[model samples]
Target: MAQLGIIGHKGRMGQALQQAIADAGHAIAGGVDAGDDAAQLADNCDVLIDFSAPAALEGNLHAAVGAGVPLVIGTTGLTQAHHTAIDNAARVVPILQTGNTSLGVTLLAHLVREAATRLGPDWDIEIVEMHHRMKVDAPSGTAILLGEAAAEGRGIELAAHRESGRDGHTGAREKGAIGFAALRGGTVAGDHSVIFAGNEERITLSHLAENRMIFANGAVKAAAWLIGKQPGRYTMAQVLGL
Candidate 1:
């Protein structure tokens, strides 16, 4: 059995991961929260799963590389610098990083990409997501993940073709642009929908997360799949063999 470690032991996701690891029949190497020595926990585990703050990511990557173990990063709201850090660290150790770990969401992104590819540029794409009230990030990472998928299928850069938070005299929607809307309230686990609007018809794809356990379970499964993998960057798509 794989010995799994948690990097944000006190957080909600971290707590849920504990139960998930047990349910998956894996051993818990240990866990660490803010100010805890992540290097210590990494040394004892075959793989690491991080659901911690963005500020702690660099240190976590360092610890994983030092321990020569794989890492699964489920933390969201990461900036470009954070991604660059992950890319650099991935050169030294296997790392599976994703905005959403749910298997359903992964497949949804695959479908979104396929749909975007088949549809003409005239179809406007919009992504909407909802999360718990306590969530700090707007547009939820899953929304961005889905937007990226659509962008890839359209052979465009999401950063250049994305729009969000519309208000006052926003004028007309740009053609071929991907729009995003975020909602927060009522302890919602998570909900995301992608809409493709054409001239006469509309198609919407969605995934609703009922609980954090789904994410926790997927993280554990990904951690197990990452063990002994070659040093490189990976995604949930790879984990699901999509």
Candidate 2:
């Protein structure tokens, strides 16, 4: 059994990860909250799982690399600079960064990619996501993951085709555009839907999260899977054998 260290140890996902580790027949070496020293925890554990805010990713990455530990990053709302930093760090330590860490969501992304490939640009693509009010990010990271899947199936870059939100006076829908909408309220764990609309028919794919444990369990499984890998960036699809 590997020893897992949790960043953001007192948060909801961190607590869930604790249970997941035990369920997976592993042990928690210890945990570090916002002001704690991640390097110390990394030195003690075989791997690290981070579910903290975007602001904490850099420090966590440094800590993991300094102690030569694999890391699983579940934090969302990361920017391009953060991605570049991750890319750099992955060269020194195995790292897996993903939006939603649910096995179902990984499979859903596969299906969405396939469907988008068969369908032509005549079909309009729209992604809708809803999360709990406490979630700080808009459009949800899962929404972006699904969008990337669809774009990849279409053989196009997501950055060029993404349409995040439309305001007043926005004209008709742009052909070949991928649109996104986000809703937040109540205590919903998470909900995501991707719609493909054609002239007369429409196709929709979705996944609903009933609780936080789905993500926690997936993260734990990924952490275990990453233990012996080479230093590099990894995806949940890789962990799930997709």
Candidate 3:
């Protein structure tokens, strides 16, 4: 069994992870809060799971690299530079960074990719996501993940094809742009839907997160699998054997 260390010990996700660790028969090495030193915790654990904010990512990644431990990062709303930092850190330690880690979402991404590939860009992809009112990020990380899958299937980069905003006087939808819409409010754990709109027809693929436990369970499983892995980036797909 792996010894796991949490980066955000006092948060909602952190509490969920603690329960998941117990369910998975893993031990909690320790944890760190906002002002606490993460590298110290990393030194005592076999793997680190970070479900903290974007502001904490750099230090957390550095801590994992310093201790030569694998890390699973589920924090969302990260920028390209943040990803670059993660890519660099993965050279020293195994790292898995995903917007969402639930098994169902992972499978949904796979299906979305295949459908986008077979249906052609003529279908016009769009992603919509909803989260709890307390969630700070728009378009939810799961939506972005699904959008990336669609972009990958189309053999294009997601950044180049993104259409995140449509407002007053917005003419018409771009031919190949991937649109995104986000909804906030209520106690929703998470919800994502990917729509492929074509002439006289539409195809939609969706996944709903009923509770926070699903993500916690997925993160725990990923932490377990990451132990003894080579220094590189990983994904939920790899953990789920998808």
Each prediction's RMSD to truth: 0.6, 0.8, 0.8
Let me know the TM-score candidate 2 reaches against the reference structure.
0.98
* lDDT tens digits, residue span 108-177, model 2: 9999999999997889999999999998888899999999999999999999999987889999888899
How much is 38 displaced in model 1, in angstroms?
0.2
Rank by lDDT, highest first: 1, 2, 3
Q: Please identify model 3 stretches exceeding 4 Å from their true place.
A: none
Q: Could you estimate the TM-score for every candidate?
A: 0.99, 0.98, 0.98
Which stretches in model 2 have alpha-carbon errors above 4 Å?
none
Q: Clashing residue pairs in candidate 3, if any?
A: none
Top-scoring candidate (lDDT): 1
lDDT of 1: 0.95
Report the C-alpha lDDT of model 3 over 54-74, residue by residue, as the tens digit. 999999999999999999999
| TM-score between candidate 1 and the true structure | 0.99
